[model samples]
Target: MNATVIIPAYDPEENLQRIVDRVWDLGNHVIVVDDGSDISKSDIFHRLSEKAIVIHHEKNEGKGAAIKTALKYIKENLWDCNVIGVMDADGQHLPEDMEKLVMKANNRENAMILGVRSIGEDMPLKSRLGNAITRFVFHSLSGVKVSDTQTGLRAFSYKLIDKLLQVEGTRYEYETNVLFYCAKTEVPIIEVPIKTIYHDKENSCSHFHAIRDSYRIYRDILKFSLSSFSSFILDYVLFCILTVLFPAGGVGILFANILARMISGGYNYFMNCRFVFQTGTKTQTALQYLTLAICILVMNSIFLQIYAGIFQIPVYMAKVLTEISLFVISFFVQKKIIFRHKVSGRGMIKE
Candidate 1:
């Protein structure tokens, strides 16, 4: 695969040597980014510098920054390297599992590979719950169903590296940022099984404060959720205004509803295009969204009329019932059709 393994180390006290040895055994070049670790204390990392191309950051730049540096070096060198794998410096990431990821990356040179941890067995309670929350956030915000959104054992093709380098976050939340970027660029993600080996004695781990880091990840995906809420509010407020102005039985009702939907839909399109997806807007993007909105409106109106007229349900209650049904179609249309962000990185969403 002509692959290169990039490991970003920051005050790494775990089994870094073993990881280095294993990457070498796999017959892949290694790039260790020492993220401002004290040279005196990190003697082992210093020694391994001889075996791999070491990029030292005098200041402790975050993992995202370290990756950005390594990616630049790889691109500048013009390495024939097709696959790039990354994992933790801690002994948690097994050498054998990494090989499995590399093999998968070799076969699917165009996909992003994720090493999914089988945390179902012997997992810490805090770790499990934290991962669950992150997983929910990922699916809700990105429309991508992923379980272990925070797993460190990941691999990506060269094409993905080019895109990943453009991501903005420079901390532990960088992985979360990558997920959003991949979604935007249509990166294929698949997950392979992995084992969690937590050998931290005092658990005085890196600066990855779970609460603080999780908040950052949440913030990164907030744009999508916020955009959706904005659209919902716009639709609801406008619908109310139209209903009051036109009254239910007037001919003006249909036109008012349709116009209100278009107004709200426009707000959603612009927000999702610029903030959520962060991609260049296609000429037909707006038309596609409008079409979807029209379909939703028709479905909603039909359901409402049937329920309110035939079933004798209250008008407001019928509207609510219809809106609930529309949720499924709206989600499917946005995920599978309209905002069809293809996953490039290979990984399964697990919790």
Candidate 2:
């Protein structure tokens, strides 16, 4: 595959050497990022650096940062490399599995190839539950079906490095964002089954901070879900109030719905800007958001007018039905267009 393998290490155990050796034996250049491992671990990195390129960090950065560090290195020195790959230093990812990803990427240069893991009964409880939950939520929100959302063994055309670098997250969350971004951008994904290995029974080698990192990974979507639900509540309540006061059902539905949507949309926009998307760009955001809200409002009005006005459905029932139908569309627009995350870098990139 003419690939460069990037291994991100943070206080890694002896298995790091074994993995590097295996990768090197496979005839691929290896780059290891010593993500601020302990001083005692320097000897291992030093010895491995003789064969594989080793980059050291002054202090501990998250796994995502380590990967990015390696990616930056690849971008500058190994731009001619055909493929770029990432594997875990924790020893869970096998070199052969990595090769599978690289080969698949070689076949499909336009797609990102993932070495998906099989979550079996033998896997640790936390690992199993974590993968299952993350995989489900990721699919539900992004509409991308991935078997293992957290698999570190992945490969793609060297061209993808820049796109990945532009993504947010310097921790576990970064990988999740990568999946989300690809799904949003319509990037093709090819998954290949890979062998799952756990050196320890408890999977204790993983440095993932269960609570802190989980929150980091799911924060954006979590906040967005909360903001959406709350906005819906406010919208529903306002519609009820307006209906009671003005006594509108058919044609009156348009007036009542628009008034309620405007108010709720304002609140939703405020929350998304300040908290949910955390978008930093000031250009055209107001105009973009206004356009999306208008679209949603129009859709909502039509649904209500048709359901409650023509069919004589109850106003509240029609309102609920209409809002539910528009929910996914509104969320998609806000996420993909109105409040998309700003890329950290500019220009063409991939990995």
Candidate 3:
């Protein structure tokens, strides 16, 4: 199989040359993206250019942008290559592991192959904890159980290149975005076990910003749910206000529930469209959201009545329980049905 390996480098250490040399020896075309490294580091890329196609960024673009640039280059120039692989310029990814991913891609023409590392006891504390959290969050959001959600060593067929390029995020979050996109689009993923090599500590030469990048990554995947939570809070507060204004009987509770939902549901729809999902035509999304709101409204009213009216629980506490019960259901429905078109595959989604 014809394959091209893309290495996105930003101020990489001297070990980059060795990585590039080994990758070249693996008998695949190589592209090294110099993500605006400093002048002193220019010699590293200059030397690499002799052995591989070196692309330069005038200034530092993030890793995602650099990879996108390389993908664009491949699309425009080396379109004949059937497989595309991405690996970090840092020495973490072994050329053999990358080869394993490539071979896996050759077999599964429509699947993304990841080089998953075992997080052993010897792993750094932060890395182990971070990967565990990210893995859990990724599965929660995407319903895809990936052993390594942050692995840079990945390979996919050429058909997926355009789809990946369209994925949002321009930093470390971009890698996580790819997984979300694949899961939403029903794209298959295959994991290949590989050796875990951490030079010094995991963060020794790594450019990953734990707090900032973690927020970005989680924000991208959880924005919809977070927005829904905000709307839920508004909905609950409105419910409480309406309950206070009206009587404490079922009639009063019914009115308060409907009116409060009308207000908060509208806000939720607006926020989800403008900030969360951020795609699909306004009319179509509104229609779908309207349906979802009605369903949740019914469910919410039933739960509130059971908790507050029949069970005689406090109205405010009942409201919280009702909203919490429907939170996961609402998010999944809206994401899978309402916003499916946003990240739906080009021709991959089955009608």
TM-score of each: 0.73, 0.75, 0.86
Per-model C-alpha RMSD: 4.8, 5.8, 3.8
Quality of model 2 by C-alpha lDDT: 0.83
Model 3: CA > 4 A from native? 248-250, 281-291, 306-313, 341-351
RMSD (Cα, Å) of model 2: 5.8
Best-to-worst ranking by TM-score: 3, 2, 1
lDDT tens digits by residue: candidate 2, 42-140: 899988997799999999888899999999998888867888889999888889999878877777776777787777877888988889889877765
Give Cα-based local distance difference scores for all models.
0.75, 0.83, 0.85
Q: Which stretches of candidate 1 lie over 4 Å from their true place?
A: 1-3, 21-28, 36-50, 58-60, 78-83, 103-108, 130-149, 156-169, 172-192, 200-221, 240-244, 247-259, 279-283, 302-328, 342-351
Which residue runs does candidate 2 get wrong by more than 4 Å? Answer: 229-261, 273-351
- The TM-score of predicted model 3 comes to 0.86
lDDT of 3 by residue, 202-222 (tens): 557788899988998888457
Residue 124 shift from truth in candidate 1, angstroms: 2.6
Find the number of clashing residue pairs for candidate 2. Answer: 8
Task: For residues 1-351, write the lDDT of model 1, one tens digit per residue.
Answer: 687888888887747877888888878888989989886647877778867888899998888899889999999894698888887776778877888888888787666678887656466666777788888877765667776787889887877777788888888888888877666566667788888786553334545777777777787356656776677778777877887888566355565557777887788788877876665478666678778888887876677678877898875576567666776566556655666666434334331
Task: Quote the lDDT for 281 in model 1.
Answer: 74
